[model samples]
Target: MSVMELLASRRTYRRFEQKAVPQDVVEDIIEALRLSSCGANRQAVRLVVVNRPEDVARVQPLVKWAAYLPPEQGTPKADELPTLYVAVMQDTSIPGDLATDTGIALANMTLAAWAKGVGSCIMGAINKPALTRLLGIEEPQKLAFMVAFGYPAHKAGIVPLTEQTGVKYYLDEHRDYCVPKRSREEIARYL
Candidate 1:
């Protein structure tokens, strides 16, 4: 698929099939992170790959799911959990834009995953302290985000934003994700 097509189809995926992601795909995701550009090339971002089923299960509860919808509709069932989790962290000892670096790395990783037919969700609303402890993250390293990945079980797509639709993403009647996006004309201006 073309890059634009890939970008358009790479929506945030919450519900996933229980099938495991291939090891090569997981490695590619990590490699994407490793090669992602960072401010000043500090490359302060660190990662912890939770590909083992048991370890993935341990990390699941510590990370929250979609916030726009109620838990019943947004959270995945036990059988629908992601097969992999990659914890994004920042090395405190290396000073840089943590947020920007993490964002770049995540975009690269997720895009790479999607290109390989894997779905992903970048999670932020999580039990950070507990996760840090559970993942054995130490000083000089701080957990920033968790990315869940697997084969998607549901579909998600962009919907035009209307007066009634506001901006929050919602589950359609079919339970597929409907993310409302403002038109380019509404958000951009030509110089």
Candidate 2:
């Protein structure tokens, strides 16, 4: 796909089909991240791959989601839960939080996974201390982000709405999906 097509196709895929992501594919994505543009070409990012449902269950409690989306339609079966997790970390030696930089890396993986018929969910707002303990990460550096990956259990598509439009994607009382976009003319400004 073209660059624009790829960008438009990307989405945060939280649901997953019942399958395991090949180790090599996960490795390749991480390899791509290693070559991503860092602050000073410092590849201080670390990724921990988790592929066990038991581990996912253990770690799931520590991860949180934005309130924007309703609770998931349904949870995957014990074995069907996403089995791959990429833990994005910032090195202590670095003098920065690396959140944005790491997000870029996660974004790369998210898009790349979608391209390869995989799905992913970028996670934040979770319990950091608990995740640190669960992942056995002892470095006092930083925890930039975490993402879960696997075959998608749901359809992959876009819900387009720019900031100029007041339309928003929100959940209804019945836990249904809705999108309300604001007209561009209403919010656009001429300087």
Best by lDDT: 1
Q: What is the alpha-carbon lDDT of model 1 when measured against the actual structure?
A: 0.94
Candidate lDDT scores, in order, read 0.94, 0.69
Clashes of 2: 9
Clashes of each: 0, 9
Among the numbered candidates, top TM-score falls to 1
lDDT of 2 by residue, 25-91 (tens): 7877887687677676666778887777678778776776545653454334455467688778888
For model 2, the local distance difference test gives: 0.69
TM-scores of the candidates in the order shown? 0.98, 0.78
Cα lDDT for residue 187, candidate 2: 69
Residue pairs with backbone overlap in model 2? 16-153, 17-152, 17-153, 165-182, 166-182, 167-180, 167-181, 167-182, 168-180
Record all residue pairs in model 1 with backbone atoms less than 3 Å apart, i.e. clashing. Answer: none
